[model samples]
Target: MKKSILLMTITTITLTGFISGCSRDYTPTAEATGEDIFKGACMECHDAIEGKENIFYELTADNKNIEFFSKKISGGSLLMPKFPNITADKLKAVSQYALDHSADK
Candidate 1:
């Protein structure tokens, strides 16, 4: 009886943990701010959106416009992945954020 009770308790705890730890939601919601998106996606590889020391980073040629930033970010590059899920507003926001924080600025 004691062994049976112990086994049931263990099973209950294990199941509870397993069920609670699971996440079935396949899609993650987009962040509201440009800075948020930059931090979430761009920061991983680029590190600093502006003030980059790498030569390759310099040639990005923002062109002092949100359009450039939007194109580069949405289109992706050789090493970077495309951000298809980013909404138009989010795209604009992030682009502006990058431009605002650019090395020149």
Candidate 2:
């Protein structure tokens, strides 16, 4: 009787662990931030030190919209590479950050 009870307890504990692990939704370790995304990706090719003028100015001057910017980021521009892997939310955040900085001037 004690052996059966021990076996059942072990089975229950194993099942509980397995079920809990499977049910957990994985949370990404680092949430993407606009500034971090821009610095990591956009700055690679677009920094002023590289002799490329800041894109924010042109974006504002042309009255470009966030939707347009997000699409271009995901789809790539004539001079830019496609970033379709970037999440839509991250793109919007980055676009807004750029626009906000553009207006600072």
Candidate 3:
């Protein structure tokens, strides 16, 4: 009886350890850069929008103003598409870059 109990206890511990060791350690991928995301997604519509005469002229004039443009880029208004899929941090970085590097008037 004593030997049987001891064997059962050892078997339980060994099985537990083996099962735990077999489990995978999951690690998430690093977040994508704002420029990368923009080049992949937003550039499509933006190129056309920026090509329009009056709108392009207006945006070019105020492009460097982050406060005015960041919300528009992240949330979308009028004809712009909302980047809802982007993480907040990435959206902010992309918005900042766009505002900072906007076409010079």
Candidate 4:
């Protein structure tokens, strides 16, 4: 009886650990591509003059550049409307794309 109880306790602990490890608190964002998000949200005002060049011309990855642009989009700027409904991950992707394509290299 003791051996059975010990085995059951060990099994319960192992199963609990496995179950907890498998659970994730964050929901995975849909795989929205950079170009897709940019075209959908940003292209209305800023023209995609040369593929990703337009976004690159105005933004960068350094100096909190991505955060700056994300805030602008979320809060609304002089000429740009507030994209309040946009998800954080999508904004991040767009900012990353601009930074990656920027000519500041």
Highest TM-score scorer: 1
Cα lDDT tens digits for candidate 3, 11-80: 9887666444321222112566656655555655455335653222235555457656657755666455
Runs in model 3 lying further than 4 Å from the true structure: 1-29, 48-63
lDDT of each: 0.62, 0.60, 0.55, 0.59
TM-score head-to-head 2 vs 4, winner: 2
User: Least lDDT summed over 10 consecutive residues: which range in candidate 1?
Assistant: 19-28
Screening candidate 2 with a backbone cut-off below 3 angstroms (N, C-alpha, C), the clashing residue pairs are none
Q: Which whole-number lDDT from 0 to 100 does residue 47 have in model 2?
A: 46
Cα lDDT tens digits, model 4, 15-100, are 66644432222222387676676656655445544655453454333644677667765676544456655657777777776555
Of 3 and 4, the candidate ranking higher by lDDT: 4
Clashing pairs in 4: none
Q: Considering lDDT, which of the candidate structures 1 and 3 is the better prediction for this target?
A: 1
lDDT of 2 by residue, 1-105 (tens): 999999999998876664443212222125878777776666545545233355444544555667766776677654565675566577788777666555422
Q: RMSD, model 2, all Cα superposed? A: 17.4
Model 1: what TM-score? Answer: 0.56
Cα error of candidate 1 at position 101, Å: 0.9
Error of 4 at 79 (Å): 1.0
Q: Which candidate is the best by lDDT?
A: 1
Candidate 2 has its poorest 10 consecutive residues by lDDT at 20-29
Q: Higher TM-score: candidate 1 or 3?
A: 1
Superposed Cα deviation of residue 100, candidate 3 (Å)? 3.3
